[model samples]
Target: MILTKQHLQNNFAKARETNSPYVFVGIKAEGVSEVIVIPKKSFDAKEQFYMNAYSEDLTHVMNNNVMITGLSYGDADQIPNII
Candidate 1:
């Protein structure tokens, strides 16, 4: 998902409000595409489950939820510093 500047700002604000330690950052060919503030460790543990979910499935699963999925699992190269 391509996130607009406002979307990022909102996510950051949410992260601050919730006092989250980690945020899911998605990177595409162009640059960073999305940011999701994961609110549950259980959800983070199911990374593969979220990774395999289709976009439409993600839309349904993420309805009224803080966790957003469907980011490419293999996009690690995009952030060499983090790796």
Candidate 2:
């Protein structure tokens, strides 16, 4: 089944409940955008690891990254970055 934004919203809702990381791959113009929705507890470790690993020539690309939060199930229309 195709995963729509609604599916993503539901998944994130559940993740928020269990405090788990919600990861999803979305297509973007530049490349594949990997969205990892982690609660505050998990974000710190993930942030450190990604920052270290991606802290090379990808500084510019990473700096342009757009993060979205508090999106409702129907707010997929708001995410123009998601294709």
Candidate 3:
């Protein structure tokens, strides 16, 4: 799924008010992805100050929850590594 700028802003606002983290998964490219954790403060700041648009891609399994996937599960592990 793709998150529009407005959706991110709204979620950021909610997270700011609740002092919670907002998590999102984004596909960086074909066959690659990333999980983003936006802290309350950072979310507020980004939404307040950043005017540029942003988007996030998520997996079909994860859906709209806080879970993020696509990270590598291996010996030399990286949070967003593919394969």
Per-candidate TM vs. native? 0.34, 0.31, 0.44
**C-alpha lDDT score of every prediction, in listed order:** 0.39, 0.39, 0.41
| Ranking of all predicted structures according to TM-score, beginning with the best and ending with the worst | 3, 1, 2
Screening candidate 3 with a backbone cut-off below 3 angstroms (N, C-alpha, C), the clashing residue pairs are none
Tens digit of lDDT per residue, candidate 1, span 1-83?
A: 44333443454455456655544544332233454334344334444454444243233233423333323122234233322
The CA lDDT at 55 in model 3 is 24
Q: What lDDT score is found at residue 75 in candidate 3?
A: 25
lDDT of 3 by residue, 1-83 (tens): 44454555565555556555443333343444455444444654655542343324322333334322332221232334432
Residue-pair clash count for candidate 2 = 0
Residue 4, model 1: Cα distance from true site in angstroms? 0.7
Best by TM-score: 3
The lowest-lDDT stretch of 10 consecutive residues in candidate 2 is: 66-75
* Candidate 2 Cα misplacement greater than 4 A, ranges: 21-27, 32-38, 41-83
Report the poorest 10 consecutive residues by lDDT, candidate 1.
66-75
TM-score of 3: 0.44
Better of 2 and 3 by lDDT: 3
Candidate 3 stretches with Cα past 4 Å from truth are 22-25, 48-83
Q: Which candidate tops lDDT?
A: 3
